[model samples]
Target: MKKVALLVIVTFSVITTYGSIKSYNNLNISSGTMIAILIMIISLSIFLTLIIDRKTLKKRYIEKENELKHLNTELEETNIELESSYKKIEKLNSSILKILELSSFFSAPKLMERDFEKKVLDLALEIIEPAENGAIYLFDENNNAKMVFAKGYDYEKINELNLKKNDLIIPEKAEIIKDIHKINKNKMSPKKFAAFIKLGGNLKETLITPISFNNELFGIITLDIENNSPLKNYEDYHTKIMDYFGKTFAGFLKMLNFIKQEGKFHKDIALTLVKTLEYYDNYTRGHSERVANWASLIAEKMNLDKRKIEQIYWAGILHDIGKIFVPQSILNKAGKLSPEEFEKIKLHPTKGEELLKKVDGMEEISKIIRHHHERYDGKGYPDGLRGKNIPIESRILAVVDSFDAMISERPYKRSLTKDEAIYQLKRMTMKQFDGEVVRTFIDIIDNFNIK
Candidate 1:
């Protein structure tokens, strides 16, 4: 920019000098030497102006370049900071997925506080990294929240505090906190919840985040740090980071609620289906529920995961769904079944599997239902999957199904005693059923005092 300015100024100076010399020569004056000196003076003046303009332009260009460089440096720093923040968010997202997976355990009819606390705290700590103290409080039906788990705190003293339901008592000052309750009541803008922390008789900062699910506040996750600084202090992007964490936690809780509702819905539908099947066939009255209970017990004895146990329970409840398609005469026949009638009965497992496969998310349970009739020696119907090729769940279901059949009253035979049922199971081990699964079944029956 400076070089262009200098060139323009030099060209103008040369043109002006030439014009002045030409005018002096055309005047033909006696004072030729004076006119020549006058031209020299004019040329010098133009040269000085050009030099001054060049200096000014150089100064401006240097200032502009320096300003642009500073801006580029700041932009680069910002981009790096944004990239780091994004990576942190991604890590937080992965942690939330783990929390969701853990929360699936609570989808059962009963929520075990011990298990819930252990899993919740583990995930919470990972999300809120660098926190020295934390606690997870659960909301009870009476609208009160109680601490179920605490880390890095004196349990006895904290328990003595007895934080009430929706109660916001600051431990250090005994001042009743107010924002949390207002937020719960108002449903307006976000409210900040804070408390004073006391460490060695000195006041510090304490913060609590309220956990909410489905528009109902569950409990607070409390944190205490050493200094009196605001919770929003320490990290420059603390507000944004905390907000992201809170939203993620909320999403996880929502997903947990959804899963729980889904599981219950499925259970209800399965039970209803069992009841319907019972209504249709007197011989199989109460058979589905019994099978479900036995299957669940067998699954537990086999040390199956909660998900598998749940699948087994549902499969047991709906195992006879295919019986709905069978004719009433054949199902209630009082004599030995003809080969054709028996073949029809054998199709129930496959029919049930086909019906359940239409519903989404029931693939595992449906597969178990379909394969429950399979023999360990690869002689079963639908699919003759040999040992180990069958799903372990299906194997467990096979034991429970046969046991229920033996012990339940039928048209052609009477029910067996509990001991007789166990004896029969032991008699068929390996040849007709998985041996280890049968043992597990026996153990469960013994331990639970099942009659």
Candidate 2:
């Protein structure tokens, strides 16, 4: 539009100037007057066109330049967003891998505090990379944070500091101190502020994440990075990460508690069952306890692991639970039992196994109870598993069970001395008993002088 207007103005001026010059020459005007009038009209028209064109060009260039600048700014922002998203994805992947590793570690049947703390510290460092120092302060049973593990601190310096429970700062307190320093608040005492600053020690960047289980505060994990490179606008992100970690740790702690509780429950149940059986039979009152004690000793002598020892003890207590099915007449018969009655009595081991198999975590103990009567030479009844085929626990039970039976008075027979029982066990070695188990049992008795 501007170009068209300028073209029209120039054409009109050129025609007017030509007409004026011709009239002046025709009317006999002086040559000087004609020349001056033509020059003035031409110069005035050229000046007006130049002014319009310059203003139009300058306005167009300014508008175009502003559009380009806006586009460049938008492109720069998009690139920044893309870069931020990439970093987040990378952090997410790293977090996932760390969680998997932590899960595997915590899944073990047993977890020691020292080993667990090491794993926690390793994961903390991975999440807060480039940190100069790290510490895991676990809340003790009393709900107080105590530094359980630390990395990148001088042992001598730590000991010299002697930072007791009171001196150690809590998570809330640490956050307050950090907030105060961030805003440069001077209301706090200088001495106290200095001590707080010294605790963190030139590390302006610090992260404190709480470790909690079932809404119970378990501990806190803190990481420190270099001064002046502190994370910006990280409260929300840090909270989310900490919450995830806390929930995971809480799950592991719950599982551990459950395992411990289950173990105690099993022990308590075994003790109660033993007591019930003892109440039913006068001759066997306290008999299960003595057998369990002896069986555990024998197991230890044979170098069995602690879990196996526990199983052996529990099985010993319940080994005779099947005797409940036997008639009192037969069980307490003062005279020798007929062949039929003796055969009926021999079924107790199978009955005991069947009865105990219903209980969870008692399957192994049931198997031991079932095979307790089996002879090492395959002469015993109820499946006659011989020698090593018999579970070691059952073999140990057999030795202890027989020893307790001999030492306890019964309706059919009087009690034997410890020496006599030991002698009888030696005689039955390799036949009614595993020779190794019998040997260990005898050694246990001799060592403990239980007679």
Best-fitting candidate, scored by lDDT = 2
Q: Write the per-residue lDDT of candidate 2 for residues 147-212, one digit (tens) a residue.
A: 667786543344344343334444532231243244322533565446545554565656666666
- CA-only RMSD, every prediction: 9.1, 9.5
TM-score for candidate 1, residues paired by index: 0.62
Worst 10 residues of 1 by lDDT: 192-201
Runs of candidate 1 with Cα error greater than 4 angstroms are 1-114, 126-130, 137-148, 152-203, 207-220, 226-233, 414-423, 447-451
**lDDT score of model 2?**
0.73
**Range of the 10 consecutive residues with the lowest summed lDDT in candidate 2:** 172-181
lDDT of 1 by residue, 50-89 (tens): 8878888899999999999999999999999999989777
Q: Given candidate 2, what's the lDDT at residue 390? A: 92
